[model samples]
Target chain A: MSWLWGAVIFWLAAWAFNVWLANRPVARSRAVQLFIPALFGVTLLILWEGIVRGLDVPGVILPAPSAIWATIRASLPVLAGDFVQTILKGALSGYLIGCGAAVLTAIAIDRSPFLQRGLLPIGNFVAALPIVGIAPILVMWFGFDWQSKAAVVVVMVFFPVLVNTVAGLAASERMQRDLMATWGASYWQTLVKLRLPAAMPFIFNGLKIATTLALIGAIVAEFFGSPTRGMGFRISTAVGQLSLDMVWAEIAVAALAGSAFYGVVALIEKGVTFWHPSQRGRT
Target chain B: MKDTAGIATPVIEAKGMGLTFETNDGPVHALKDVNLTVGKGEFVSFIGPSGCGKTTFLRAIAALEHPTEGTLTVNGMTPDAARQARAYGYVFQAAGLYPWRTIAGNIRLPLEIMGFSRDEQEERVERVLALVDLDGFGRKFPWQLSGGMQQRASIARALAFDADILLMDEPFGALDEIVRDRLNEEVLKLWARTEKTIGFVTHSIPEAVYLSTRIVVMSPRPGRITDVIESPLPKDRPLDIRDSPEFIAIAHRVREGLRAGHGDEV
Candidate 1:
């Protein structure tokens, strides 16, 4: 009862603070923007801690935030291993391979009318396939290692990147192409100089989307099979052992990793596509 | 300069040139029996109502669109061969400068494609930037510039490669009247400096009269040349020249030519 009251008060306080911040006339500096979200996150954790501890909730049902934090601190080596296995070995490698292959395939499709007509529909079909439906089969085919996880990530990521890149390749304006033609630019030269550069914004959009997809695929693929190590494997085993704190800790790592991955890609996009209208500010 | 007859060979020659586009609504004749010759260092403007194939004719000269019948040549070569030889620079209706590139980079595009040395590209880029009066704006992106400035940067780009012929399809049509007038004066000065044969397309009577040594007026619906008016105005033209009697007379003739073309439609 006290926990519920504390939660209500905290929620109201946080909400009022956020509303006040939102209405303020002060410049929305980068620090303020970041501070608001960080404050909200901290408030939520504090409320979570207060509610769980005050209510004396069973550890199996929902561990307190403090317990989760403790678990994270205590199991650094193990968490680092899972991070390396799931993120470094599986997601990163698969993201690179899948995105590279998709870009190459998109270029091929752009070059040939026949392939564009034939392959895009097939790519769409492949993208529609459920990850769960394909994960087990990939695990069986590639054996229950990081390779199978990478394969699942690849399958999950390939189509989006391919479709976006193909669209981007055709994104050059008609006048721009005519200008190239007037210069007597060869097909290859035009592709290199005009189409490819013009495609960067769209291609970055696809890459940003693929980053999260890769992480999700890698983590989820390990649910089917993994080599006694990985965030997914530990999460599954932690539940059976009734170590809810461990599960929460794994979730925290995954969330952080996913966010970092996306942030890095977005930063790169901002750098590369600074000329784009969408990326106009902060030269 | 007006007496181009029996001088050096005409820079562009079109004989019975026609183009019919096959559309869903049946064949649309964009140009028909277009006969014209543009002499060396001449500034020729084509004026007509919409769908009169003025742009199509300019595009045909650029080898961007093929003429279905008759013949057109640039500098004694077929349009395609002349394009391959990089005989001309073309400016579209909109200033189609790539947004990703700076003004200097846009100007250097043709030079890079033509395999000009880096030093030569830099020199030409500087010269053309000065020509267009966008000297300090070379480092700015296209989107950062105003529409008029962007168009000037595009003109700088066209002038960079030093092509003997420049084909412009309503290049200043999108600008406001003030910017258009300023650019018109600059274009005259550019022509005087470069002496390149220019084929300009415009819908404005005053624009045609003020800019061209000769204005070829055409009608729509099976587009064909209706009349050609030779401007007797002097080479040096000020913005106030449009108020001159000679300029007004040429403008009136162009207006009459345009009305006659529209009357044929009615």
Candidate 2:
């Protein structure tokens, strides 16, 4: 009871301090900008730790943040292996292949009205298929390894990038196209110089969306069948063994990896599209 | 060889030209029975109200639009063939500069497409940037510049290729009055320097009178030319030339021609 009350008091005090800090002129500074979110995260951890200990909750159901942290530290090597197997080998490779193929297909189909009409609907249908339905089939075809997981990820990411890139290729204005025509620009030249650059904003939108899907597909597909070493495999086994801390640790890793993936793409987007109105006027 | 006499060969020629757009509302006559000739080194203006097909005519010359009836030619070849030959540079109502590129890069775009050498591309970009008085703004993105400056950058882009014909469709229409006036002055100077055959479209009577050696007055509703007035204004025009009697007379005749077109509609 004292632990619960102590947590409540601390939460209110921290909340008040954050509000005061937010109102201060220094809040706009870069250090304070970073500090506020870090502080809020710490406060949540503290509250979770206090509440779990105070309630004396069973570890099999829910582990404390500290327990999860401890498990993460203890299983560093295992976690690193899982990270490499699932994220790096499966998700990253699929993302590169899927995005590359989609962009190429978009350009190829752009010249043909027949293919654009025929292919886009097929892509949409593929995108709509249930992941569970396809995962096991892919696992059988590709065998029980990271390859199957990558195949699932490729299926999940292809449609968005294809649709976005096609839409992006058509994004150049009619006047701009007319100017190209006046200059007697070859179709290849126009595609390389104008259409490709114009399509970048839309392509990045698709790419950013694909990063999250890539990770989720890779992890979830591992559930159908994996080589007994991925994050998904570890998570399932740990759950069956009633080590909730290990499951929480994997969740933490997934969350961090997902965020870092998204952040890197968004940073690249900012760099590539610095001239865009949405990206301009920042420090 | 085509010039049997001393008469300068016409750069653009149209005879009984008509363009009809097939829309859901049935065929709309955008241009009809339009006959005009723009000679080499001539500055011609097409002026009228909205839907008068002034822009349509310009687009036809650029081969961006095709005439359903009659003939149109640029430099003695078909408009399409002339476009293929890269005989002209076109400027739109808006600047239409690529947002991702700097001003200099935008100017270099046509040069790159036309397969100019690296040294030549750099040289032409510099020349046009200076010609449009946007010299120091070469590295700035389109959005970083003022609207007037962006329009000038676009002009520089059109000038970079040094095409013999410059087709402008109300290029300064979106700008404010003061910017428009300043741009008008600069355009005259540019025309003087380059001596390119120019076809300018505008809605303003003063703009037509000030810029053109000939003004083609047009009207809407099965858009056709109402009158064609030859300007007697000398080649060397100062800003104050607008106050002169000759300038006002040409402006008044253009106004009357426009009003007569409207009078027929009413």
Candidate 3:
């Protein structure tokens, strides 16, 4: 078809342009660096739109990026309410409580050797339980509100942070500890000065992993039951009604929001653990 | 027990020390009835074979490991009491610099722990950095520096607090021969300036002979002292000293003693 021919020509042109751009001479300016990537992403989007329209794909199966954008513009009020309810209220609160409690638990476990032996197994087991399995039970227990969603998130996030912190606390070298011992440093002094700072990279690793988890938990928990305002509820209900365009719009929002949340945590992690080798930029 | 008030008395004196670790093969005696004394402002080196108790003995002195059957005192006080009194500094095999900290900041750790005033901490950091020849590299992280530089920083840290005793455990074991020679001279200069009592542990024969006033060579199984050699080298040393017949003789003697203790095992 003429449409297929046009799409292929455009794709080939974009590919050639990408290859040219990547192999360009060093004398190229900085603006080209930004422009090249933007050009590729836009080309991909345009190709997607062209193919879907050319094939006459059902809206339920696929929505063009422009169609998704129009739907999002029309439903800003609904989407904003969901974002507020799910992310700001539920996910944020759950994240703080869960991470704080894990850190405190890690300290306690580090103190009592008996607790470390007995409790770490339970914490690891708890971490392995699926969010899908727990969401319904938590909704039943916390009674189908934002409270249940937060509880699910807390369950989802608690162990990774705790285990990573405990492992980090133990990661300081023997010489470092011996130096403290020779200095006549008290147990508290050594922990405060050496072990805690050494544990920072691991703690940030756990925090970054937990960020995406917090988002996932908040959204999934809404599927079991909620006040019909959260993201999970809208997504599930829109799918049932075959409002594919609305679903695509909500997905676009979730992807952007989730990415933004993850990016912020990663930036904070870079600031906190700049000494870590993993954070060093080779390029 | 050593005397209570005389500054000339031995700063650290151990009477009949013993250490035994219970293993799957049964009790392994790591140290046994080892008696030694380190006097004020003396430089002593503990040299021995791999399994010998030189490190164990020093750990006992630091109160890091307890001796099972003897009393040890530092400056007429218990090891724990002496540590609390901040009587000594220790440098381990690695530089033990915190990777997160800058070179100057790692040197400042002890001062920070003791709550030194901000101005005093800065002055001390500046002084020690220069003393170690690491001036103007204050803000560079530990990982950014080479091994020799990091070890120099570690030495600077031990000297920063003006503590009168230093225990260094194979501090230059990882460096090349050239760097080790330089560090050995620098450490001697530091000792002369500060007049600190130093107890060093090493496995190298030439190293022991070069820097030590007295070298205590030890043997392994149920680890015990084999020989104690007093060096005849003058206080002021020259690079050409290594080529001197006197240095070679002492080094050969140490190697023989090490072989006497170690080679018979297999």
Best lDDT goes to which candidate? Answer: 2
**DockQ of candidate 2?**
0.87
Tens digit of per-residue lDDT, candidate 1, span A94-169: 9999999999999999999999899999989989999999999999999988999999998888999998999899
Residue-wise lDDT of candidate 3 within A1-283, one digit each (tens)? 5665677689889889888887888417778778788888888887888887788778889998889999999999999999988887778788988999988899889889999998899998998898889999999999776888889889988999999999999999998998888777778889888998899999988888888899999999999999879888999999999999988988888888889988998888888788878876622
Q: Which residue segments of model 3 deviate by more than 4 Å?
A: A27-37, B1-7, B263-266
Q: Is candidate 1 or candidate 3 better by DockQ?
A: 1
Greater lDDT among 1 and 3 belongs to 1
* CA lDDT, candidate 2, residue A169: 97
| RMSD score of candidate 2 (Å) | 2.1
Question: Per-residue lDDT for B73 in model 3?
Answer: 89
Question: Residue A136 of candidate 2: its Cα lDDT?
Answer: 98
Off by over 4 Å in 1: A1-8, A21-27, A281-283, B1-7, B264-266
lDDT tens digits by residue: candidate 3, B1-266? 22234347688887887888889999889998777777898788989877898998888888888877888888899888888888888888889899889999898888888778999999999999998899998999998899999999999999888888898999999999999999999988888887889999999988888888778888898888777777789877866788899899988888777788775564
Instruction: Work out the iRMS of candidate 2.
Output: 0.7
Query: Which one wins on DockQ?
Result: 2
Give the range where candidate 2 chain B is weakest over 10 consecutive residues by summed lDDT.
B1-10
